[model samples]
Structure formats: structure tokens, C-alpha cells
Target chain A: MAKFKKSALKENDGISAPETTSIAAISKIKEKRRQKKSTSDLVKAILNGNITALSQAITLVESKNSEHLEQANAIIKACLPHANKSVRIGITGVPGVGKSTFIESFGSYLTNIGKKVAVLAVDPSSSITKGSILGDKTRMEDLVKDKNAFIRPSPSGTSLGGVARKTRESIILCEAAGFDTIIIETVGVGQSETAVHSMVDFFLLLKLAGAGDELQGIKRGIIEMADAIAINKADGKNLKQAKLAKVEFNRALHLYPVKTSNWQPKVMTCSAIENEGIEAIYSMILEYKKLTIDNNYFYSKRNQQNKFWLIQTIEEQLKNDFFTNSKIKIELEQQLELIENNKTTPFVAAEYLLGLKT
Target chain B: MAKFKKSALKENDGISAPETTSIAAISKIKEKRRQKKSTSDLVKAILNGNITALSQAITLVESKNSEHLEQANAIIKACLPHANKSVRIGITGVPGVGKSTFIESFGSYLTNIGKKVAVLAVDPSSSITKGSILGDKTRMEDLVKDKNAFIRPSPSGTSLGGVARKTRESIILCEAAGFDTIIIETVGVGQSETAVHSMVDFFLLLKLAGAGDELQGIKRGIIEMADAIAINKADGKNLKQAKLAKVEFNRALHLYPVKTSNWQPKVMTCSAIENEGIEAIYSMILEYKKLTIDNNYFYSKRNQQNKFWLIQTIEEQLKNDFFTNSKIKIELEQQLELIENNKTTPFVAAEYLLGLKT
Candidate 1:
């Protein structure tokens, strides 16, 4: 294990460093990168598969620092041709379903098989509290130590769904960086899980054996989107219960129409802690890849996901822009008061507000 | 019982007619009523509290017919001062949890006690299919026929959460109609339940006994927001299991912080089919009302709900405007194609499409 002193780690090249010069240099380079024929440069880096540059470029796109966005656009344009080659997997489960533990074990398995893996954690905790564990690297210490693995925790300070947009952009960067497997792990199954699922190629759901609350899962529709379900902690005393859960889940999954991919949704049991059945899971993924690629469904699915992301991004930005506009603020406040007073119906207030805009 | 054919009903009153002539006549009469604005007229109307007029007003608000919407706004404004007197209760449960049965029994109990009861259903399923068991009068056949009970099924054609907005508007109409107890029944427990919950004074979650889906409920957080939980089908062999489930739910409810209203959530078992425990449910609601009103939390909570609806309405309109614009449509298609070809990243595509507006 390589350990460095906190002071040493705070040096220019270290993780904790302020890196005033490099920060300044990066900004300057970004500005210059903006002025140059950025599209061509972006194209070059993306074709050459530079992951760091791709990630930095994505950050520029997501940044509130408006000045860097244009340059980021150029870089994305350059990288466009090399993107969409890898499998984008979104994994979700309940809070205590051992999501991180499963990812750690699963991710380590992928790395050992000569695959470059990137894990991005998309925590849905509110930005204000800053309470997210972002414990991917901590949980998957072995994978983090491997040269073939790259793990990034949830980027703090954004909406749960908004964090997913950044993660999607980061995936392109990881692919350009030579990672073949990109796994996005969301904290729990909810609206955020749906958001992540919409942006990925394969959606995996992890479950615990004998979840005392089965109806909760059915109501949320988490099981419906799942392409594959793995009942984790399926060892020792839990084995029979895990088998029973697998059967129950299979019955539920049957209710959904066959997915567009035409692949029969699969359910299996695994012990992330015991590192058992990890190889079978990988084999299933490979089978899925071969089946989809043979039918030319892989490229088409990615295309659809990209379009979904495009529209979702536009909708989110437009919402923020309209609500945050200085001009609409007063009228909105007044209308809210009217609504509170029961002097105006919401529909009427909405119409009046929109009329004000025109 | 009063029975009238659709045509006969339409002929009796100008407001019920679908023809332009009757619509014009109703509008003219409404205009005259608006201009007079006599103090006696206002007081008489408030004191009398016509339930039929209130029902018609709510229909006008939910109607897609643009002219009806204007009339609805006028009616709501006139009735505003008389509103806010009702004890608004929102009840939600997973499909087949006997939501309608509970409402039927509960509404009957209230009406029998000299309280006028109005039941409105918010069905998200109406949005996509436009095919709903509208006015599921059959589900509450007895209550529907009761002179003191009013039953309105879901209004068709709107988004999931958006449907609840109309229901909220209808609740105000119901209150003005002199219905002192208004129960808003949601068809399912999902996102729509949250919408119903935010607009009501008290929210009740119904569950089945011995179904063993408790873990599933926790995952979705439906049980968390519940002000009161009732394990239905508590008669017969399931009675013991219902009691056990109530104990488990009570423990789970304790994990949530005391609500802002300072009301301790309660759990009970009921047999809605047998009409047992309905009175107990009513008494619990009354207790909640008295406590919150004395603490000055009741009106304040309603005010917050009104504000939430106002902002939500504006946001929905803005999104609709952006998506429906002819100019945006053309550019959106072009950017989607660019994304499909991998010629642009989704973030860049969004920025470009939005930038085109300027």
C-alpha cells in the first residue's frame, strides 16, 4: 500500500493541493482552448481516447462558469466520433441492499479480467446537507487501488437528477480514457433511479433476500425496469430465502411486457461479500452484449439514450432559466399570494404569469 | 331517485348544454351576476352553498374547453371566501388495497353524522388512456345515492401530478358547497399520492393485512408521509395479521420525525367492506383537525399547499410552452439528429438548441 503524508499530499500534484498555479494554468489553457479551432482539437483528443481531457471537457459543459462552456462544446464535438462504444450500466437498490459492497466486488471482478472499469456514484442526498457518503472508493478499496479501475464519488451541490447528467458526460470521458465498462451506482431506488436508468444501456437492480417489504418494491416500479436482478448476500442461512426471493421476483418480472431489447430479464443470486457467483454475473453481461450487438440493437439503444439525455437536459435548463429570471420573480410572488388568499386558481395564475411573459 | 337522460339533463339548464347558444347564454348570465356583485347575493350564495353549482364549477376548471376554464375561474373567485371550512383528508394505497371501499364506508359514516361528505378521485391512469372508470359510482353505490354524499370520479386527461391540481381546485369547490368533510381518494400510491398529500390537511395510507410487503412500502416512502395508516381487510381470518402489521407499521412510523403540524401519526386496523371502525377513523380526523387548528398550524399548512400548487402550475405551463413552440420543435429535431449521429454531446446539443432562442 502506498501512503503519503497529508502535507505531501497537499503538494501541487497531490489530491488535496490548492494547485493555484495549475488551476490558473488550466483556466488559461481552457481560455486558449476556447479561442482555438476547438472543434478540431476536441475531435483529435476524443479520437485518440484521452479520458482526462474528456472528463475535464464534460465538467466545462456542466459548469456554471459560463465562460468555459463554449470551449467545452468544442471538446465534445471533437470527441463525438469516439463516444458510445462501451456498455453503460445503471445499478440501484434499497439503502441496505449492499449496493456499494456489491459494486466493490463486481467492479474488482471486472478489473481482474483485464477490463478498465470506471464507477461513478450518483448520490441523491440534498446538496445543502452535504451528507452523502460517496463511499465507493472507500468500500471498494481493492478496485480503487487497481490501475485498471477509476472511481469518482457523486459530485456535491446539485439536484439528484442533475448529478446524473454530469455522470453521463463523465462516462463519455471514461470511454475515451479506454475504460470498457462504466457503472453508475445511485444511492437508492426512487425518481433518481429512474433518471439514471433512462440514461444507461443495462439497468441492474440489487436486492436482499427476504425483503420484509415486498409491496413497497412493486409500487415503485423498480423491478419493472430491471434487465437483471441479483439477490445479494445469498450465502449460508440466507440461501433458501434468497432462492424464494428470486422466484418471487421472477413472477413479478413476468408481468411486464418483453422489453424492447427482446432479452428475457434474468434473476440470479450472488454473495458480494463471499465473492461467489461473480464470474456468472460477468458471463451474463457478455451474453447480453453479444445478443444485442448481433441484432444491431447496441448502437440504436445508445442513440436513443443520447437523445433522451438531450431533451431532458434542455427541459431542466429551461425550467431553471424561466424560474430564475429576475423579471418573472415579482409577478410569481404576487400570484403566489393570490393563490394563498384563494383569490386566484392555479390555472388562472399560471395563465396570467405566462401572459406577463409575452 | 332522480333519473334524466343525457339530452334531457342537457335541456333543463343552459350550463349543462354542449351547444354554443346555451354556452353563450350561460356566459352572459354569469357576466351579469359578476357585474351586480350585491352583498345579499354573495351572503345568500355562501350561506346556501349550492353543491350542484360547486360541482359544475370544478368541472369547468378541469375542462379542456378554454371558455369553460374562464368561467370556472370566476366561480372559484366568488366561492373563495366560503372555502377553507372543510376537513380535507387525502387517502392513498396501492392498487387493490381497497381505497374506494374505504372511502365509501368512511364517507357514509360522515354523512350519517349530519356532515355533508364529498369524495373526489384523482386517477393518473386517466392521463394516458383517457379511459377511466370515471365516477366509479358503482364502487360506492350506496354513498353515491345518498342525498348528503357527493361522489366525483377522476376528471380525464392530464399528467399524473397534474391531475391532483384539478382535484385540489375541486376540494375548494366542495368546501364552498357546504361539504364539511372532503375526502380525496387517489387511485394508486406513487408520485400521484405525494401530490394529493401535499394539498390535503391529513393523509391516510391504507394497506392490506398479511400481504407481507412491508419492506416494499419502506422503499417507496409512502408509509413515511402517512398521517394515519389503516390495515384494511381486518375482518375474518386476516384480523390477527392486520393487528401484527399495524404494530410493525407503528414502529416504522416512529422513525420519522414528529411532523411540522405536531401531530403524532397513528395506525389503526379497519374492515372497510364491513364498514367497521369507520367512526373511529372519523374521530381521529376530528382530533387531528382540532389540535392543528388550535396550534394555528391548519391554516398555515393550507397556505403552504396553495403556494406549492401555484409554483407547480407555473412550472408546468412553462415546460408546455417551451415544448409546444413551433420554432423550438424544428431546432429540437435537428439537435436530436445531431445527437443520434454522435456529432454533438447531449449537453452541447441542449445549450445550442436553447441558445438558438436568443
Candidate 2:
């Protein structure tokens, strides 16, 4: 019964030890200094590539306080000139596809090749799950510790639109901090992929070799949006299937019309954990960059994205205002019931509701 | 050239014969009576299967006159209980894919099987080309004369949304007129296909076997929407290629996840000009109807589509109202210019514009 003995009680780290009492005073002074910093001082620090300033600016951007929002908008406007210099890449895959591993290996490779990398996420479900995807730093332990890399979990928000807006602004902050490459990671499940695709220059879909067809479980319209597909975990017993998947995907990709960028989307096999094939993927992206830039699509696409976002924001706000109106919400339910009973058509009901809003 | 000389001394139909002058008096009286008839009477006549009344009601729906729209809404509300009884099938194909011939053959089959067919179109380009798709009665000469069939060209509207609304309203008129099969046809280019897809129970894509791969010229996102793909012009030398295309398309269709309808989309070869394979297509639709009905998806899907239309109309109207505001328009341009100069972000610009509107 006594095969194991009880270990000695350890000091609780949750409670501050007596010797660390002086640290509290330093924290209060630091907080006071942060409060005293002006908007211009924050902007200058961010432009000077100060990581702490960048993090603080992003926090302001993600804040709910109207005062913070005003400051954040001012900071972003100041940083706008320095943005759009980075190659923003969006990477997405299902839960078990090793997205963090891929990013760790690929991002580390970028830093090694003398590129500054920033990783952000746009998980719409982060609010409910409380940032499940990248909340744990141990998932990408090495990349998190790398000096040239900045990793931020998805910002929690009440809606995908809010979260996407935060991540997009964070991208500007990251870019102004002298990062040349930005990676936005979204889970393969929701509307987040489309939001990510709109903001990024190149979209890479991460996949795993299934037991059967390689294209079995792809979300609709995703292959069309992807600039490349990387089959992660192509190591040990999975290598052969991954190669076959690459060939299959290549054939499938050819069936699509030539992209507007005139750069054919590429498919490759990579072992993120084993650190295999990451460099080839990077070269492929660079090649795509060269082609799209030469063809004048890079700048034009970014301009289109800007216009799209402007219209998208306005339309979303318009819809929110209408649907959230006290009278419209109640009358909308009645119209739907009328629609259910076939007493009114959707068009007629919509007209009635619009009149109510006015 | 002499043989082709103008036919000698034919009485001019445009000027009318002297004896027909009496008929003009009767036309005036009939016009007066039509004007005097109330919306309820028009609704009653449509429910009684009066083709003239149905056509007049649809014209009102397509009219831009405010008074006509009011009357149209009244008639539609009265007819709403009689609508939603027919099966709506959407047919789309690129120009020169023989869309008219396919509809002629397929629609005639439905009529022969004792079904009343109403053929409508949603050509967004109709405004520019003056209703190019079905404006010519000769395109479906036989069907145009069939008492069991009602055909309407795409309504000419400045916006696709307006045209789509007219067609949708006309569908109600046709259904109330006792048409059991509603066929909505759209050209394969632009946004018309999506509009048509949202309104129909079954979406059929018409394709021609290309010189190379059969999938070479398909517009993006179309194959995923298709419930069936019929390869036309398969009577001549194209037959062999059409069969090969069927096999290729079958494989491609399998790659898509199962539809919410739980019906596997089919690929078939049909010679519309030769009138072959028409009945088989009908049988396939009946089978799909049976499966969906058994699974309770048929009613659920219709309900979902109704809710979708209601929300869609509200959103479109909201955007229209916002963008059409004169003050917002000028400010929007200014904000865009600022965005181009990197002085403002899309989010901030949108906020400023929205604030100005309020």
C-alpha cells in the first residue's frame, strides 16, 4: 500500500512570495507610464519596430471603449502609409491538419531566410471557445520565442465581422513594425476563410492525406480561392499518399480556368514537424509574387480588396442597423410568419418591413 | 435577284384593311373594360387559368409605373395562396449551347405528359440586348403555340435585382394560372445564374462537349450549383464526345459533397434537336422529388428559400437606399480618394460615411 511516498509541499507560485513585494511598485510605475504615453508616441514606437508598442496598439484596436477606438483609428491612419509592403499569406485547414506545426516550420524558415514574420488569426468562434485555436502558447513554443516572429491568437469578438476587422487592423500594425511577411491563419470551418482570403495576397490550404480521394472533404469554393495547397504531415507512412494527393490535386487544379493572376496555383507535399519541404513552398510563393507583380495584378488586386472592404463594411453596418431596430425586429418575425402561412410573398413582406424602418 | 423581287401588291398588315376599321372600335371597348377591372377580378381570372389575364398581370409586375406596382402587389398577395404548388426548374447555358432547343424539347415533353409549363427567363443582359434570349418567338416556335405552355421573355430592367423580382412575381402569376411546371431560364454568364438558382428547385446546366476537356469553359461555382448537366448536340458526331463528357462529369460531380437535398446530381447526354432523352430527364426529376419529399427536405428547403429571399430583398434595398443618398455619394468618393492616398482606412471611411447618413 505504501509503494509510493508523498512528495514535499511546494511553494505556491500563484501567490506572490514575500521577497517579490518590491516588484508591485515597478508594475504600478510601468502602468502609469503606459497611461501617460500619447498617441503620437505610440505611433513612433510602432514605426520604430518596438514589439511592446505594437502589442499595446493592437490591444487598443481590439478594445470596446469608444475612446480606445478613436485612438486606435488614429494610430492605424498614421501607420497606413507604412503598410501594404508585406506579402500577406492566409493559411487554413481543418483542426487536426497541423496548422500550428506548419506555421511554426514555415514561419521559422522565413525568419531564417532573413524575413520578418508575423502570425495572426481570424477565428470567429474564438469568443465562444475563448480562443481555442492559438490560446495555448506551447502549441508553437519555438516560433513564439523567436525574436523575428510575432504570434497573436485570434481576437475574441461578438461577431466574425468584428474579429476580421480587428485582425485586418492588426496586420497594419504588424507591417508598420517592419515585418515583411504576415501570415493569417483561420480554421477551415466558417465564414472566416472568405474574410481571410479578402485580406491576404496568397491563400494556402493545408490538407492531410485521407484514406481515399484527396479532394473528398474540401469546403466548397475553397480550391478556387487557393493560390496553393500544402499537404501537411507527409512523413513516415503518410508520404506516399501525400504524393498521390499532390498529383491528384494538380490534375484537379488544371481543370479550373486560369486564375486572374495568371499564376497557376501550385500543390506540394510538406512535413511540417519533420521540417521537410518548407523551403520549396516558400519559393513557390515568391515565384507567384514575381509573376503577379510583373503582370500588374498584385497592386490592382490590393486596390480591389480595399474597395471591397469599404463596401462590405458599409453594407454590413446598414444591415445591422435595420435588423437591430426595435420595430423592424418585431415586424420581421410577423412577416416571416405570414410568409410561412403563404399569406404574403417574401418580396411583399420585405417592402412592408422596409416601410416600417422608415 | 428577280425571283427575290418584292411580292406583288400584298395588302399592308401594318396599315390594316379598310374593313378592319370596325375592329378598332371593339379594341377600344376591350381596353376600357380591362382598365375598369379591379385587382380582385384580375386575380380571379388568373386563378381561372385565363392566359390573357395572367400575361396582363405579369406585365404589371414588370412595369415601372408606381400605380401598376401597387396593383401588382395586390394581385400577388391575393394569388399567394395559389402559388408554391408548382416545381420550379432553372435551365442555364452559355450562348450557342442551344438553350432554346433544349427548353423546347423538354418543355414540350412536360406538356405532353399533361403538365402545364410556364417558361420564364432572368437574362440580366436583356436590358442591353432588348430581351435577346427569348424575345424571338421563333426560338421556341412550337412551345409558343402550345395552349398548355406559357412563355415570357426576360424583363428588361436597369438592374438584375429588378429583373429577378419581376420574374419571381411572374412565377406566382403563372402558378396561380394552374401551371404545374415552372421553368426559369438564364444565360450562363454574369449573376443571373445565381438569381435563377435561388428561385428554382432544380438547376440544370446545359453544356457542349468542347474540342478538348468537357469542363474547359464552365463558369466558376456553376457545376457546384447544378443538379443535372445535359450535354446537348449529341445527335451527330458530338455523340461520342458527349458520352465521354458524361463520364468525366460524373467523376467531377462525385468530388462535391452531397447536397443538402440528399440527391446525387446526374450527368446525361441529350439530343434536344432530335428529341431524344427528354422523358428520361423528367423521370430523374420525379425520382429526386420523391426522395426529397420522403426525407422532408422538399418543404424544409422551400421554407429556407423563402427566408433567404426575404433577407436578400431587405439587404439589397438597404444598400440601394444608402448608396443612392446624394450626400453619401459625394462623401464616399472623397473617402475613397483619401483611401487611395493612404490617409484613411476602409473601416474609418465607412464609419464616416455611415455617420453622415444618420
Measured against the true two-chain complex, the DockQ scores of the candidates, in the order shown, are: 0.34, 0.56
lDDT comparing candidate 1 with the true structure? 0.76
Interface RMSD of each: 3.7, 1.3
Instruction: Find the candidate with the highest TM-score and give its number.
Output: 2
lDDT of 2 by residue, A1-358 (tens): 3444355654545865577457889899889977756899999999999999999999999999999999999999999999989999999999999999998999999999899999999988876457657776787888899999999999888788899899999999999999999999999657889999999999999999888877777887799999999999999999999999999999889988889999899999999999999999999999999999999999888888888899999999999999999899899999999999989989999989999886
CAPRI quality band, candidate 2: medium
Candidate 2 ranges beyond 4 A from true positions: A1-36, A128-130, A209-211, A235-240, B1-36, B128-130, B209-212, B234-240
TM-score of chain A of each: 0.80, 0.91
TM-score of 2: 0.88
Angstrom error of the Cα, residue A16, model 2: value is: 21
What is residue A303's positional error in candidate 1, in angstroms?
A: 4.2
Worst 10 residues of 1 chain A by lDDT: A211-220
lDDT (Cα, tens digit) per residue for candidate 1, span A1-358:
2455546445564468566577878889999866744555655665565555555566675677756766665665555566677888888887788877888899889988888888886776735356454453477778878777877777664586567776776777677667789998887634778778877878888888875643343434677778899989999999998998888888767666788888889999999999987888888888998999888887788877778778788878877887787878888888888877778876678778778775
RMSD of 2: 11.1
